[model samples]
Target: MKFKTIVVVNDFSFVNGGAGQVAISSAIGLLAKGYRVILFTAVGPVDENLAKQGIEVVCLNQYDILHDPNRMRAIIQGVWNVKAKVVFEKLLRTLNRTETIIHFHAWSKGLSSSLFSVTKKQGFKTVVTLHDFFLYCPNGGFYDYPHNKICTKNPLGLSCIFCNCDARGYIQKIWRCIRQVIQNKMLYQIDGTLFLSISDLSTSIFKKYYPNKKALLFRVNNPVALLPLFERIHVENNNAYLFVARLSLEKGIDLFCEAVSQLGLEGYVLGDGYLLDTYKKKYPMIKFIGWVTGVEKENYIKMAKAFIFPSKWYETFGLSVAEMQSCGIPCIVPDKNAAAEQIIDGETGFIFQIGSLESLKDKIVCMEKMKMEDLARMSQQAFEYSLRENYSMETHLENITKLYDSNF
Candidate 1:
């Protein structure tokens, strides 16, 4: 393979998010393939794992929108960070434009759309992975936090602008709309730019927003990191249903707790968020394991009867769903979102009606009644599909490398 320098852009140098992990994994894969790779971010002290891979990281060491305590400054920077533009411009100028591909995984965390405009202004061909819906929706998820449901209002429309869907409040919603305006002004920046959408569901959701001009769009599945199947035995019986995502309202954490409480079933929440204390107080029986990774995460999934992926938002891809499937664990997800795409219903796992607590509880009741032989068959099917399909890191690397080669 001919050596080509690849610039991977994201909000964080640390692998704390789905988009950031994908960006880091891709950079590492490129480096192993003998390509020069650079991870460009607006936040942090970098992850030691990236440095160990010999990939160069350029971080502005700025605070992300979530971490920045200065509310006014964070809002302003979220719209357009002039500092990021200046720093990124300098980095772009140093790289060989002809052999370099600027691939953006995320920008909503801190690096705003100004980075896109700057990349285009510098006359470099760029690629953006639609990790979320920030390019179209103001809050990223079309989810209405206040209402606890998905919002149908068009992006920046009168209704969308008026409705307070932001988790913070209406004031934050207004600021987000302002950011959307700034983002729209530079939508042309991504014109003729390649888009690496993580799922067909994401492409369908944002298809209307892509520039009118022809732009290459590739459907690249998120690479799931998993322990080899041969390393352990699959669990044939488990008592509790597990929820492993961030314990946020959009993740349907409340719904899970409610259903678990109603059914008088054992429920284990393996992640933490703002609503953790509130939910724990309301549902004392439900167990909260806080945040966990590696073996701890895998063991939690393995010991569960079925993994519950009740995301209320239109997730681009559910990494946890895929990870659980890899471990021969069935996942019960909403029939909407990208997680539903991974399930085969009665084969791999099950699907419940979107935003319906009753439907989820009924599914759990049905699973509890399932025969051991039937459950084992479904678990085996889930594992085989995840391992054989494009979800594996090997397949992700191959697809990315081919995309890179095509651009060259």
Candidate 2:
């Protein structure tokens, strides 16, 4: 029953975003641990780093829902990807189910929940990481996109369906609801164990939906590679704050801009999205550096006074906050969601009331008034806290492997 190999499934082989990065990182870690790891993805050219690590990668060479040109086909595939089912069926036949664990990172983006039905029909034990609320909620963020508020209505309920929550419009909302039904059916057909990144919040929400008494749940925090102690403490802190995430509305980039403008403070954005050009034109004061990675992205964070995470949604886990903290950088997060959990208010960083520009500006103004020595103390505390609690790549590998071993 000991797992000798792990199959990590997601929608993309390339690191598209947080979920893809997590899946690829986990595969690389398994390879380093001398375990046979396979990266199974529906739409990808394949990540070179994973292939370089001597891990097997099977990419279907298709397009994700976002990239697919055919709208109808994309919508259908988003619900049920029959091609993925057939391909995975053949792959499942090759693996010894007892020695292999199929761990799914994401499916809603492209792969769809049809893969779960494949695993059940093939009689293989599987695990699913709650990367987002796609398995339970229609729009995947438990957010009412039209209203730009947190959604509390029950999924698929008449009230939920009656309300238009999709960012695209009412049509997309209906499509997402239909897709949710398909995902739910496939999810309930199998008894896969759950891996929750933020156990306190995500686990509870998931349990409310599924509530399978026999389901095994594990709290495995997403891994963040710790920077060296010298880099963590030695970075020169500038006067400006930094925001690093996709430049989207739900990400609260607009809110961050409004807060900075109110305080007459400088802010820098390090990621790109649909709203990049619009944000650039609307807020000429804030510098939008498009997107950055590796040392460049790290340097932006290191030079900033504080990392500002103003996401309006309830994040399952805020990986960027952990990364910033690991580098001895204080963070400003909303009082709600997982980002708040990463920082100790007024100590490691500050947490402001959600959706309040005055509260956000006040928090930033407070940080602006803090003395250099006080800031340094907070940064040191942030770094120490991250290293101790926020898991590293090594810790994550050990945790997931232990879960695999214990299950069987």
Candidate 3:
């Protein structure tokens, strides 16, 4: 490997979210290939899996932007953390920029944009995975939370700045705008920039507004944990429609609840969030299982007649939908997002109008009307499609290695 030293930078040491999990897994996979790897994080206690693998991890014990105890300090650090800069600079001092690669999976939550400034000054070979829209959009989702629709306004423009699209509030929106300004300035100063987008839509959306045309953009697959099975899982006997994601407005959980309740169908929701309690009370008919993982989550997947992903926002990639598909579960997703790419409409599953309650309900009814043989056939198709995509850890490593080789 030309770039023998890979330092994976993220906000958390553990699998806190999608980006964090990717960061941790990517590092571990790289180490398995015998690359000299280091995991640098801004939040701790470290993930036990990393420690078990004997990977070098540098944890800068700090709170995430939202959870930091001192509100004043959190606000200041969110923009540029002096401590993060100093610590990261120290780490860079020992590395040879020619052979070292600084790959950023996440930062906004804890590490801040200070680390980007180090990359700029040091001129190390760098790559950034567009896991979320935080680098460009102020609130990160590119969706107007107040209006509950996708926001088309260019980020940092007058309309975008004043629209109050942030989930928190307008003031937080202002702070995000400020952070973007600083982050942009730091990014422009660096050269030979590489951005690995999770999906084509994500790359297209990012290219529309991003000022740096010289920045190299490439689409890459995120390695999903589940793999396709040899024999198809029995889907005919499954009783309930499944919704597995955080219970939030952007996730389109309400739409799922509404569609399921309207049709009087059995439904299961297997995740927790701010809206969990509210949704549980509002729709008592739907089973709301809070945050099941491992075998418990797997059992829910096995029991699902069909999986639903009605994301209101422009999700770069839908992880859960792919995971369920790998388990031979047919998935019904909206046509707008990348998850729809995995589904073959009525064959593998169904594709409803994105964010439309009535359209979602219609699809649920259509799926319920599907004959047992058709349902089982679709399950086989879904599993075959997901498995054939080959989004395993080994394939991801091969793709990432190719990406690195091409960049250099």
- Find the candidate with the highest TM-score and give its number: 3
lDDT of 2 by residue, 1-408 (tens): 277888889899898878888889889988888889888888878888876789998888889997799988898898889899899889989999888889899988888888989888877878888889887789999898878888999989999999988888998999999888887777787865555545467877877876575677777888776555345654235777898999887898988999887788888999889999998898999999988987787667666888899998888888888878887889999876878888899899999987777888999888888888898888889988986795777888888888888776
> Mind giving the per-residue lDDT tens digits that candidate 3 earns over 1-408?
788899999999999888887889989999999888899888899999998998999999999889998999999999998889999999999999898889999999899888989998988988899999887898888899988998889889999888888888999899999999998888778788788988878888778878887678988899888833455678878888999888898899999999999899999999999999899999999999999887788777777898899899889899988888887888889987878888888899999999999999888888888889988999989888987988888988898888998887
lDDT of 3: 0.88
The number of the candidate with the highest lDDT is 3
lDDT head-to-head 2 vs 3, winner: 3
TM-scores, in order shown? 0.95, 0.96, 0.98
Least lDDT summed over 10 consecutive residues: which range in candidate 3?
227-236
- Predictions: Cα RMSD each: 1.7, 1.7, 1.2
Specify the poorest-scoring 10-residue window by lDDT in model 2.
227-236
User: Candidates sorted by lDDT, descending order?
Assistant: 3, 1, 2
Cα deviation at 74, candidate 1, in Å, is: 1.4
Model 1 residue 319 lDDT?
88
Q: What is the lDDT of residue 287 in candidate 1?
A: 91
Off by over 4 Å in 3: 227-230
Candidate 1 lDDT tens digits, 1-408: 643888899999888878888888888988888888989899987999899999999898899987799988898899998898998999989977777888888888888988878777877778888888887899999889888888878888899998989988999899899998888788665556777888878888767764453667789887877655552235466787898888888898988999988989889999888888888899899999999977787667667888898899889989888878777888899987888888998899999998999999888888888898888888889888876775767788888778877865
* lDDT of model 3 at position 123: 84
